[model samples]
Target: MARRARGTSAGLDRHRIATAAVALVDRDGLERFGVRRLADELGVDPMSIYHHVKGKAALLDAASEAVLHEVEIGAAEASDDWAEIARRTAHGYRAVACRHPRVFPLVVVRARTSPVTVAAVERLVTAMRAAGLPDRVVADTPGVLFGFLNGHLLARTGEGPEVPAPVGEFDAAAHPTTAALAPLLSDVGSVAEFDRLLDTVLAGIRVSAASG
Candidate 1:
């Protein structure tokens, strides 16, 4: 527990402010988040929050940082095989996104220049370069991999059901292939589905590596 500071500053610090801000956004969401609202949430003056985090943009970034710290992502060991490390990093990143679907958007859209974000990217890129990936492939991999992960996760973890309702059988006369694959089409967002798609992405990277 943070001991309430004696007087002038409302006892607020960056960490406490960050924790409260993230909680506020997690509950009511970004549309309702603001310094005054956060101050009300924290039982402090708006100035107190400003004293710590400066502005709404900075506070949002802080909240994103706090959420990222919850998972062990991009910890690609130097000596580990690059593909294995990539798999591990992908899974960890997925875990965090699954854990915080609302905040996950910030991770995707924000220009996160924090130490945690930097370090994670550094480790993963180092492992990739060590694996002898061509310069272009090495530079392209993170954006490509993360773009896939982000799009897939946003679809799966966003509002509504995890799996879509079955389309049932289509008219075979009009849509033979659609009728045949309707069952598989409805079975979406499973762990197996996520893994298989991730493998597909990795396979493409492998091809890129081979041709590079």
Candidate 2:
């Protein structure tokens, strides 16, 4: 059994606690996570977590911030096109979420005020503004993009229902359309598929903005 480490003042900081919490979530499902458990993992008391985070919700937010900070927006900016930047950002987030499915919900709902998240949003807003999007659009684009990325990742990981396997009998009978679409659905797991969809969405957004 792993025992909590001794020494109250072990130089354990809030960032370290939050990082440990994120690691805990990555290893175990969020439903199994608690401050006490995380403290145990960190070899500290539950109260130690409070010294870093206010409560469960705050810990979750910090966990999410930690995950988002893992994204390398600077490295993803190989292309100068705003649409490309957005697509790369989406892909980066999707990759992170896929790597940490237990933390997906936290990523979607964590408060936007965390410094890492705020910096990400600022970077995104600046990109959108440079792309000729209006100030309001720039402000709202992060939410829109984040929602899309979250929904896409959730759908891809089979996080919900296992789409019933294609049935040859049912397919030959009344559900020809769905049967035909089954193969298409099967191909949707590739990164290429996501990139294509992202391109299409960004194109539509560009058109809508130009028209409006």
What's model 2's TM-score? 0.79
Which stretches of candidate 2 lie above 4 Å from their native place? 1-8, 76-78, 131-140, 158-175
- What is candidate 2's local distance difference test score? 0.73
Error of 2 at 146 (Å): 2.3
Clashing pairs in 1: none
lDDT of 1 by residue, 1-212 (tens): 24355574566788888888778877876778789888888877677777778688899888888888876854457446777877777788788878777777877777456676667667767877887888788788888887898788877766555454334334777987777677676547667777888999989988998898
Q: Looking at model 2, report the run of 10 residues with the lowest lDDT sum.
A: 160-169
lDDT of each: 0.76, 0.73
Write the residue-wise lDDT of candidate 2 on 1-212 in tens digits: 44445753656787998888888988887888998899888877788678778999889988888887887665645666677677767777778877877787787767456665577667667777877887766666777776777677766653554542323236345777777776665646578777877777777777766776
Residue pairs that clash (backbone atoms under 3 angstroms), model 2: 5-43
